[model samples]
Structures are given as C-alpha cells and as structure tokens.
Target: MAVAVNAAVTLPSSKTSSSPSIRFSSIAPERIAFSKGVGYLKNGLVTGGKAASIRAQVATETPTKVVKESKKDDEGVVVNKFKPKNPYIGTCLLNTKITADDAPGETWHMVFSTEGEVPYREGQSIGVIADGIDKNGKPHKLRLYSIASSALGDFGNSKTVSLCVKRLVYTNEQGEIVKGVCSNFLCDLKPGAGVQITGPVGKEMLMPKDPNATIVMLATGTGIAPFRSFLWKMFFEKHDDYKFNGLAWLFLGVPTSSSLLYKEEFDKMKEKAPENFRVDYAVSREQTNENGEKMYIQTRMAQYAEELWELLKKDNTYVYMCGLKGMEKGIDDIMVSLAARDGIDWLEYKRQLKKSEQWNVEVY
Candidate 1:
C-alpha cells in the first residue's frame, strides 16, 4: 500500500500577489486530488468523481528468495519440501555507529552495516528494510539509498556499503511530527539493532570499463555517492595501468562547505591525483562572490564555459550526474549555450551523446 502526500502554500487574500508552490509525496500508496492546490480526505467515500487506478506496477522489485534444506532427511534427500526464502530476515553488523550533523534540520548522515556479503557496484544503491512501527501502528517502510563508500570499502565485495542518509522532517495536518520512516530509523539505531537490506541497484550511474575515457561527474547534496565509487575503482584500485586516458572532473554543490559530503576524502584525492582530478565546489549559502552574491554548480560551470566545452568535445568523455531534479535544466541550458557557440545544434549534441551512452543521470 502507498500513501500520497501533497503540500501547497497559500497566502492571505490581501497578500496573494505571488503564485503558490505545490509538491507531492512519492511515499504514498493512494492517489490524491488537489483542487486548486487544496487536498481533502476521501477514504472510500467518493466525492462525485471517478478515482484513478490504484493498481500500478512498481519498478523497484525485490529479489525473490528460496528456502534451503528445510526438510532434509539423514541422507540429505527431502520429502515434499518447497518453500521460498523468508522475506523478513537480515543481519546486523555495525553496532557502534557514528552521527554527524552538517545541516540544522535538513540532512544527517548515518553510518551502519549488515552482516553477510553484500556486493555492489560503484554506482549501485541499497534498499533498507527498517524494523519499527510508526505512530499509526504501521510497519516502518523501506527506502532506497545510494551507497557512498568506494568499491575499495567493499573489502573484496564482502564488506558493508557505507551509506550517507538524509533525514526528512515535516509536520502533519494536525500540527504533529511526521518524520521520515527510514531516515529517522537509521538515525535512531542503537548498537545492536538489525537492519534488513536488498540491492546494489541502478545501472545508469556506473563507471566506465575503458580506462581511456574521461569522466565528468556532476552532483549535488548526497548525490556524490556514485562518484565516490568511481574514484575508488580508478585511483584506489590502480586501474590506470600504462596511462590514464581520462581526466576526472567533479562539480559538486551544497548549501555550505560544512554541508558538503566527503570533503576530507575529496581533499585527499586532490592531493594524490592532482593532475587527473579536478574539483569545483559551489557553496550556495556562504562565501559570496566579489559582487556579494551566492553561487551554485551551474554558475561555476558558466565561469568555466570554455574549458567545459573543450572537455565535452573530447572523443571518449562520459558525463554522469546524480542530484536534485530541477538542476538538470540548468546544466542543459549551459550545454546548449556552449553548443550554440561551437556552431553545433543542441539536438545534435544531445542525440550524439545519447547514441554513445555518454549522457547519464539519476535524479530524485
């Protein structure tokens, strides 16, 4: 089952000069109607209208499990035994956890682990099955979180995948706390609690197998997960044999330097792979420009438009992005502007890149 959440902001009639903003909750299982951005409850009671179909296919399919040796005899032959693996079992590995706060009420990073070999690619993510009940007496929900650790952190694909999680806190219709299910569960885990998990999903954010391809990574907030994996697979694993053909360019943005994830690791990479790795950090809420203005990744890209064009024109360059949904438009505009300057049509560049699998994105 799913629940639909809708939020809309309205000003007083006297102060209603500006347009309102509306957002939907992807977490819900039911369809909700917003009449002029106002939502009303209709639980099995029709409001003089037909309802949308509630039956829909979900893409995030869970892996099926099979039962093993449940009815084995002394000689190992079973008698009428056929059972699927239970869907509710998982292990706990990381007991003593660490918590760090970079944002006041927005994001928090939770570090934990589960026993067993959880192998995953550099760009994959895991779905967490949190164990707890909500205030409504419902079991806590499952959530997919991008793995932030490098492939090296996987310990030959047997270790845990470190996760960087963001907490979502909102108020309910009754002015009560409506916390995010998985985020708060992760944040509140004690030393011995267990967390069920499935995955290592996603294919679009993977690193290139060819060593000679250049990598351009664009990310914002916790979207840095896959790039961390890519970097480790390249530099940490020493995949650059004869000559590293790719120059790794990373463009990351956050509200402030303090909110930037993996700062220490990126700094270390800067010192080690100084020639191949280029980093540009856009701290939007602090450190104003010379004209006293804030900056973002798109703004920084504009500042380096010439170099960006050169890199994009490279023969085997791969561009990967994971971040907020609307930021892609800004990136597209910049790329189109550059394409126009280069005497090339925006559609040509877009189609060419799509044909070569050079353009990839994972936005939420």
Candidate 2:
C-alpha cells in the first residue's frame, strides 16, 4: 500500500526579497512555483532560496521531522557559534582574483585564518559582517557565503576557512554605480585585516556519508563553493576513515570559459581520477547545442538526460544542485517528459528522494 502525504515548506526570509514557497502533494503534485524565486531543499525540508542571499522559511508537519532527523545525524555540527553582536575576529590570509580580467565580472577566492576557532563541515556557510554602518545608522548586516574549503581547510591544517565571492557592482536606473557592501569589503581586504565572522551554519548541503556513493553535482559560477569542498575531500586529501570509491560527476555552468571557477583544480581531479570523476561544462557564450541553441546548463544536461535518469534510479545515487533559482525550471523541463515516458511522476519521485536524503538542493 502506498501512503500519500501533502505538506508545505517555507523558506527563510532574505533582505533582498520574499523567499520561494514549496508545497508537496501525492495526488496531483503541482510544478514548484516560485512566488519570486525558487526555494531550496536541505534534507526533505524546503528552507530558503538562492546562492547569494539566505532566505528560508519554517518547515511544517512531516518536513519538520525530516529537518530534525537530518540535524540529529549531523551530531556536533556547529551553528551560529559566532553571532553578529559578538562575532569571531579573524584575519585575512589571502585574497586573489580567480577570474580573467576581461571576464563578465570579478570573482575572488579568499582564505581566512580561523586557527581552529571555527570548526565547519564541507557544505556549511559562514556569515561575514562588513566593517561599517548602513545609511540607516545601524551596523551592516552579515551576509552568508558557502564555505569553499573542506573540514581540513585549504592548507589541510583545519586552521583556516575559505570563500568564493563575486564582487557585486551594478548600475541602477538612476545611473548611480552601486556596490554590494559586504562583497566589496571582503574583496578589497588586505592580508592581516580583521573580519567579523559568524555561524558555521546550515546542514542542507552536507556531503553524504556513503564513501561509495554516486554524487552528481550541478553548479553555476560562484555556487561551486560547496562542491569544491566535497571534491577536495573526495580526491585531493587522504582520510584514514574515508576512502571514496564511487563516481562524482559535475555539471558546471558559466557564461564563458574564463568565467569557469576552479577549472584547473577540477581538471586535475578529472585527470587523477578518470574512472571515478567526470565533468561537463555549459559555457553559454562559447558553446552551442546540436540544435544550434545556446547551451545553457539544462540544454547541456538534456544531452545526458537518459543516462542521468538511469543513474537517478539507483539507490546510492544523489543529486545536488546549487546555483541560480532559474536552473530548477530548466532541469525540470528536461526531466518531466523523460519521467513521464516511464509513467513516473518526477516531482513525486524527487520528493521521495528528498525523504530518503538523496536529493539535496541549495539554489539562489
């Protein structure tokens, strides 16, 4: 007998705008509609949306249990160890531009010296408070960024944390050049500069415990932060307790070849573990599909939809998406008909996967 469950998961609120709303149904599961943008699922609970902003609402009913259980399994996972009012003061160790000078925008890779004061996992995020007061006369709020280094840190000493940030500068309708406060502040930091840091927070994007699991990662631009942590742990570092023997396939989307983040590292990993690792890029500006269409991530993914669907059927396979909220709709468009051909409801199947902790998404 099959049991039907219907629930709604609210995402976290963001300063930017309203969070995405999610509702699950067994009878007639509607396509996930975003009030403003799409929401993200940590375990089974849909908390927030977007990669740049942290906007999650509360979970209700059975989804709440799923959140609790996921947290229980992550024993000793730190959260909010440093608050905005009393943040841990850390020093900048390195700040370098990872993108090309002529690329669409400036993206920076920065390392902060935690010195073991901040303990964080692979998929967690850290909040950064810029040193200034806002026009409202209050301190600038902390902005959360996904951790780009593994638990062992970039130097493998467990004494540092890293982040991949894109300097946000855009022109408003008034023709004024406005810069993102936190982003510009962090980007221009000198070595030894003090930083106010908060929370090694979030459990939604954590790596699976299975060493032999088939991990499929989809990321765009700076959203590759958490995936970098996972890949480093899987390929670069050696652990006595964990030895990964399964496959890790990554599908990265970017505007151009130069915009691809961590390309050299990913290429090295692919070279080192040819059998266990695979990577495909959707360089929208540089590539075109068979139909002569601009190759966005989904169009690139559609090329492997059959094979991907087959992998999705396996119990050990997990799918993780982290990037723009718009990517969700593109992925769904690819999977919907393929799932229908087999008389399966892709959304419901995805919900089941979420219930089993297999489908993890953290999109912005």
Candidate 3:
C-alpha cells in the first residue's frame, strides 16, 4: 500500500494576471513528471494550473513488491522474471572506471556474475537494491539502470551483465552535500561484493529487428548505456540471427574529451565497418560551434538536421533518443526549423513517426 502525501502548494498571483504558478516540492521524485516546457501528469495531461487554487495528493510510498503480468512494447510484451520484492543476489565480478582520471565526474563499468537464469535483452534494465537502511529503518529501494552489455554478456559468451553508473553528488539548498545511495553503493563495490539485483524492466528503448533500418541514436552523459548494448549486438557479436548492414549514426555529448565512455570499443567498431557505423562527439568544454557557443548534442544535430529530415521520411529510419529530458525542446526546435524549410508540419510529422513506432524516447 502506498502512503498518501498531501502537499499544500501556494501559487502566487501575478499583479496583472488572475492566477499564479504552482510550486510543488516534498513529492516523490518518481511520481513527478518533469519536462522541458511544463510539468505533466503520468497520463500525459499538462499540470499547468488553470485555476487560482489546486489541491494535489501524491502517493509517495514505493511498492515493496511488484509482480506485473507483462510489459508492453512494439515487439509485443515480455514477461520479466526478476522483480523488486523477490530479487536475485548476484556477485560483483569487476568494478572499473571507464572515464579518464582527469574527468569531472566518476563513471564506472560494473560487471556482475549472473547467478543462473537471469535473462535480459539488449535494452532492458536491472534493478539494484543497495545494502543499507533508509531513514525509516527499512531496506533501501531498488534503482534501475539500462544494461550496458549484450544478452550474451561481455566476452560475447557468458551469463553476466554490465552497467554504466556515474557517482551522483550535489550540493543541496541548505549548503549540504548529498550523494545518491544506490549509485555510490554500486560505484564503491569490490570484486567479491554481493548485490541484490532485480527486474529486466523497460520496453520503450527496445531495438527494431529490421537489418536494413537506419538507426539514429542521440545520447548524453550516462544515457549512452543502452546504445552501447545495441552497438555490441550489431558490430561485435557473432550472432548470425541479427545481421545489421544498415547505417547507425550515434551523436553523443559530453563535457570533456576525458568523459568519453567506451572510447576504444567504438573506434574498433568504426574501423571494422567504416561504411556502416558512424560516431560523432560533442565535447562541450573542449569544442565550440561555428556560432562560438559551446557545442551540445542539439548543436551537433542542427549541423545535419536537413539530412536528418530527409532520413526521417524513410519508413525504416528509427530514431532513438535517451538522455536528459531537457534536451527534448532543443532537438525539437531544430527539427521544426528544418521541417518548415520544406513546408512540412513538424508537429504532424512527429506524430506520424510516433504512430509508426519510428521515434523512441527514454529520457530522465
């Protein structure tokens, strides 16, 4: 059962306008639907206050047990075995830093020994339960991360799984430093450490099966996790079941050159299949655009939005975007301008893309 969380938020009335804005705090982060322009409900309704006063109650408690019947996707539904309440205890095999020593943030490549039949696909995620108690003296909840390795595992032949986790640390409003519980716990694990893992969850980021489909992957920060899995499945692995000869363009953004993750692996793949695989980087701190502004993923996309608009017209072009939710608008703006140049309504075009299951997004 979820505990009720009732928050009395004050919306300050403007001197000219009749209503004020709604400020929401003390709500569960998982329940809040934050976006680029406006906040929305889980069901896709905008939460913008149309009235002077609004009363909202958020269910802040996490379900201790989750046994969903199935998770839906374009590839049909998959019934996952592992879940939060009944999790699998797996052994940590390796914990290595993927980022350079001079990087600003700490990102790691963690591998865990699969106990037995813990099966997962290319884009699914596993839930990790930290080994500690929260303020309520209860066990810490599970945190989900996209699996960074192929279903066949690291060497292309094992039952193990991997993750790309960044240590989260930030200064709070009261001038206090806080660290994320599960991230720090995973980052600090040793070779023999025991971790409670659960759920091969999430279906939105799943890959299409067409071998000739053009894949446009846009990612930033640790959002590169799932794409890493897809790359491995396409170029590195020897799975004859899925042969990919299509064009895969990856646009990744990072703060520094040292922040590039799996840099060697991507280089090797590009060398092996130069014509089929392409990877572009937007190192913000190290490079600037023609406009003298710091180059981000959006800027990199704008450089070729016209070409991308052409590709979007193809029925087989699949665009997968996973990163900070804030980038949605910038990317949208770029596409809007490019679409307008050809007298195409980008809003309706995007809708058709979604209806065709060509546009996939899994942002945080």
Candidate 4:
C-alpha cells in the first residue's frame, strides 16, 4: 500500500535519445518526409502551415439511417450519429514520425482536428476511413484505432484528438509487396488532407472515477494509445476537480528503444511525480532477462511478480492491459505462477478481479 508523492521532472524529445538502427532503408525515405507534423515537406505533397483547427461538423446522418455493426452499448449507450454509413470529416493537424531514422518499425504521432461535436471519454477509440473508392466503387471501410489523447482533448479544449499509428509492411501471398492500406493512408496524410472518422467507441478501457485508485497498465507497441489518455488525465492535465493521490505503474514493451512512442512524455511524468508515477520498459532487442532471453513485458513482470500480486489483492488497485493478443498467455502464465504462492487458484483469482471491474483488457 502506498500514498501519493509529488515531484518535478523534465522530458526529452526522441531525437535526443538512443534508438535502433532501422532495417528497412529502401521503403523508409518515402515515409520519412510525410511523417513530420507541422513541418515542411520538401516534395510539395503537403502545404506548409498550421493545420486547420477543430470545432465544426460536416456529414450528418438522419435518425432513420442505420449503420452496420453499431457501436452502441446494450443499455441504450450514448452514441453519436457518426456511424459506418456516415462519418465526420476531420482535418489532419499533424503527422510527426517519433521513431529513430533506423528503427525497425515506423510509428507516427498524429493529430486530427475534429469538430467539437464528437463527445467522448478517456479510453474510447476512433475509426478512420481512408479516402478511395473500392473495386465496387464504395468508400473504404473505417478502421478503428484507440484514441491517444485525453478526454479533455490534446489542449484540454475538446478541440482535437490524437493517435499513435505504426506503418504495416508485409509480403502478400501472391508474391507481391504490400503495405497496410489504411495505415499507409494515414501515414501519408498531408496537413490539409480530410479523413472520415466515426465513433468514440468502447468503455472497457476507461479510467475509474476514483482519483486515488491505483492504476497498473501494461502495453506493447501502439497499444500505448489509451494509456497515454489515462496518464494525461492523471498527470499531464490539471483537473481542478480531480487530483490524483494514488500510484500509477506502467509496464511497456517494444522491439527496440526507438520504438518507444511518447517516451519523453512518460519520462516527464515519472520525473515530475515519482511518488505517483512509475515506468518500466522492456525493450526486447535492447535488453535481456536473467534467463538471457529477449526481455518482453511478461519477463519484466515476472521480475516483479510478487509485488504485482500484492497490488492485485488490494481492492483499490485496477490492472489494465492493452496490446497484441499474443501476449495474453505469457502474462497469464506469470500471473498463475505468482498467485500460486498465495495458495490461490489463478483462474479463480482472475475471475474475482473481473467481477469487481478491477481488470480491464482491450486487445486484438
């Protein structure tokens, strides 16, 4: 059990930190220039200036209109008219590449200026539709991504939303080279490009109303998005009505140091409030576990398994995990082992956490 502590700290940009050597030199240059937000694109693909601001809606649907796979919850959940059939048009504010010049993957910090009409809470996700007509002459479908900004918006003005996106590269089964259609579309977005957005979707990852509840977060790669929102609400933004008095411990995993998105901001918060914030990194390629295996978040968790178990037993603690679903078993394996130390059945123990609404997971 720990009480809140306060301190001041600073954050350093990614450019000033150590990063991995990028492996894809050939396909990278094209993506690099389009990645910097609010910066000049030497190729003239983008207009150089401040991106348009948020606060006006375009494209509304009628009440009788129906959208496929509606995002509303069962209890007549609050939802906006922006559905798959009709979506709000958002202006591209910025697209800044945050990874090193040689990192293995491409990660971008993107900001979308939205009309103030999209009401949302922390931990919700937004869907993006790439501009193009499919072979059937229909608009490309919307792809959902977690919202990386706080509920109050990037500036606490409810004017903008943000996302951390990674470019996907893979070889197609037909022996053709391919990149993610939607991901590259977003990565290539120019400052003035318009995007279709829908839904503030999902409440599973939302933060607890209790300002003093301990938050244990585990994320890998772009999964860090929602945690960014949680942290911003807890430390970065000032809510005169809400003051954080509990501890937040974040465990993050990545292929290399360069792949750590928002590292500067996380470090800044950890430094500013050492008593209230803590961060742990598991760089798979850069670090190794005691077994000499590549260190992932699971291995890092094992190192502190006992302590984590203690925290889980506390009713005030809530554990949230967001990332690729593959890591689920690795995490569960460790949890099972740790719970055994207390003479408890791990599966049953997990059930209790879920029943109490203390365990939240959003993975795919």
| Local lDDT at 239 for model 4 | 62
Candidate 4, superposed: residue stretches over 4 Å from native: 1-80
- Candidate 1 overall lDDT versus native: 0.57
Q: Judged by TM-score relative to the true structure, which candidate is superior, 1 or 4?
A: 4
Say which candidate scores most in TM-score: 2
Candidate 2 residue-wise lDDT, 1-364, digit = tens? 1213343535344453222244445532211111122211111023333310110111111222222235228677888899998999999876666777578998877778898999999899999999989999999999999998888776566778999999999999999999999999998886679999999889888888878789999998888999988988888776788888999999999999878888777776777789999999999999999889998899999999999987776656788889899998899899889777776777776776776677888988
- What digit string (tens of lDDT, one per residue) describes model 3 on residues 1-364? 1222332323323343111222343343322321111121110011224210110111123323322222144443343677778888898866666676678988877778784457788778889999989999999988989888777665333457889899999999999999999999998887689999887787777777777779999999889999988987787655546789899999999999888877777776788779999999999898888989898999888898878877776656789888889777889999887767666667766765665567888888
Each candidate: RMSD:
19.6, 16.2, 18.8, 15.8
Candidate 2 is scored at a TM of 0.81
The worst-scoring run of ten residues by lDDT in candidate 1 lies at 50-59
TM-score of each model, paired residue for residue: 0.68, 0.81, 0.78, 0.79
* Lowest lDDT block of 10, candidate 3: 37-46
List, residue by residue over 234-348, the lDDT tens digit for candidate 4.
Answer: 8766566778899999999999987787777776677778999999999999999878999999989889988887777665678889998977779899988766765566776
Q: lDDT of each prediction vs. the true structure?
A: 0.57, 0.77, 0.72, 0.71
TM-score of 3: 0.78
Instruction: List the candidate numbers ranked by lDDT, top first.
Output: 2, 3, 4, 1
